[model samples]
Target: MFTGIVEATGEVTALDLRGGDVRLRIRANSLDLSKIQLGDSIATNGVCLTVASLLEDGYESDVSSETLSVTSVSSWHIGTKVNLERALTIDTRLGGHLVLGHVDGIGEVVHLNPDARSWCLRICAPNELAKYIAQKGSITVDGTSLTVNKVEGAEFELNIVPHTLEHTGIGSYQAGSLVNLEVDVIARYVERLLLGDSAANT
Candidate 1:
């Protein structure tokens, strides 16, 4: 789990396309090497990836074919900078909210309007996931947790502060950019309750 707080920005140094998967070596620019370890799960742009090897300044992880097919990682390449977050610990402060590091689907960046102090970004998401998004509700975009400022059909707006723009990949977003998305866990349960599904049924 993560609090949606970004620790540092890491760059993809290399991606060795292994037969069925890819072994990725990431260069941590602002990532803390002290807090990382082998087998530790990290949230890379909202996708939960296990560390396969720990290097001097970065780490290596493998991305499965399914993970590539589902999320936006397929387009990723060397030099791609990504938001990095070590898995949440019991003693960690909850600055964002509960994040599973499991991205449900991809959302497209349709609008990014920059202003004096902040940026207004609008994304178009899958219609099915629309119900899970709410105005002022929690949502994770590319591993960075943010609140929904507005909602219209399959589109939602997010206000990005300077800190967010400086810390996460959303700062580099443009029209037609595809980003990973995770809806709030509580909202999922609430929707299921409203839909009449229960634990007994499943």
Candidate 2:
């Protein structure tokens, strides 16, 4: 599990396509990898990927075809900047909401405007995932946890402060940009519970 708090920003160094899957490497920037062992999980741009191999300055992970089909990873190229966060430990602080690093769907940035020292970002979520989002609720975007400022049907707005923008890849986002989105895990559980017996059938 993760807290959706980005520790550092990393860069995609290389990508090797293997038939239907991919083997990619990322430079860890300032994130500490000394304690990271092979098979440890890292949240790379909201996707929980297992460490296939450790590199001198980064690590490599294999991306399954299903992951690429459901995520924006298919658009990644060399030099792509990504949000990075190591798995949370039992002693780690819950600074953000609990995140599984399992992206539900890809969202598209529809609007981005400056709001004082911060920025207001509007993204359109997939119709199926819209029910999970609520105004003032938490949502993970590109691996960074943010509060929903507003919600309109399948669209929602977020306020990104300068600190978050500077520290994460959100600073580079623009209209039409694709982003990974993970709705609050609690919401999903609550929904399932509300469904009662019908939930099992589905």
Candidate 3:
């Protein structure tokens, strides 16, 4: 599990797709890898990948075929900047909402404009996933947790502050960019519990 808080930005040093699978190598800039061991999980661009090997400055992980089909990881190229976050520990702070590092669906940036002191980004979520998103709700975009500023059908808006822009890869986003998106975990469960009836009807 993760808190969806990006610790650092990592660069894709290598991406090799071979024989029905993929090998991803990332150079985690300013990210501490000293305590990271093989088999530890790392959240890269909202995808939870296991650390297959330890590198001098980063690590390597294998992206299975399933992950490729469901996520935007397949489109990642060398030099791509990705949000990086370590797995949550028992003692870690819940600075952001609980995130499983599981990409429910991919979204496309439809609009990006500057707000007063921040950027307003509007993304089109997949039809199936859009119903789960709500205004003022939490969503993880490319591994960075953020609040939804507004929601209109399949499109949701976000206010990206300078700090968020600088700390994560969101700063590099533009119109038509594909991003890994994970909806709030709590919302999913709530919907399941109230699948057939409203909360008041319960």
Local distance difference test, per candidate?
Answer: 0.90, 0.97, 0.94
Choose the strongest candidate by TM-score.
2
TM-scores of the candidates are 0.94, 0.98, 0.95
Residue-wise lDDT of candidate 3 within 140-172, one digit each (tens)? 999989999999999999999999988999988
lDDT (C-alpha) at residue 148 in model 2: 100
Number of colliding residue pairs in model 1: 0
Selected candidate, larger lDDT, 2 vs 3: 2
Candidate 1 has an lDDT of 0.90
- Per-structure clash totals for the candidates: 0, 0, 0
RMSD of every candidate to native, in Å, equals 1.6, 0.7, 3.1
Residues 1-202, candidate 1: write the lDDT tens digits.
8888888889889989999798988887768878777899988888899999998879999999999988888889998889999998889999998999989899999989987899999999998899899999999998999999999999999999999998788888999999999999998877668766465586
Sequence-dependent TM-score of model 3:
0.95
> Per-residue lDDT for 68-122 in model 2, tens only?
9999999999999999999999899999999999999999999889999999999
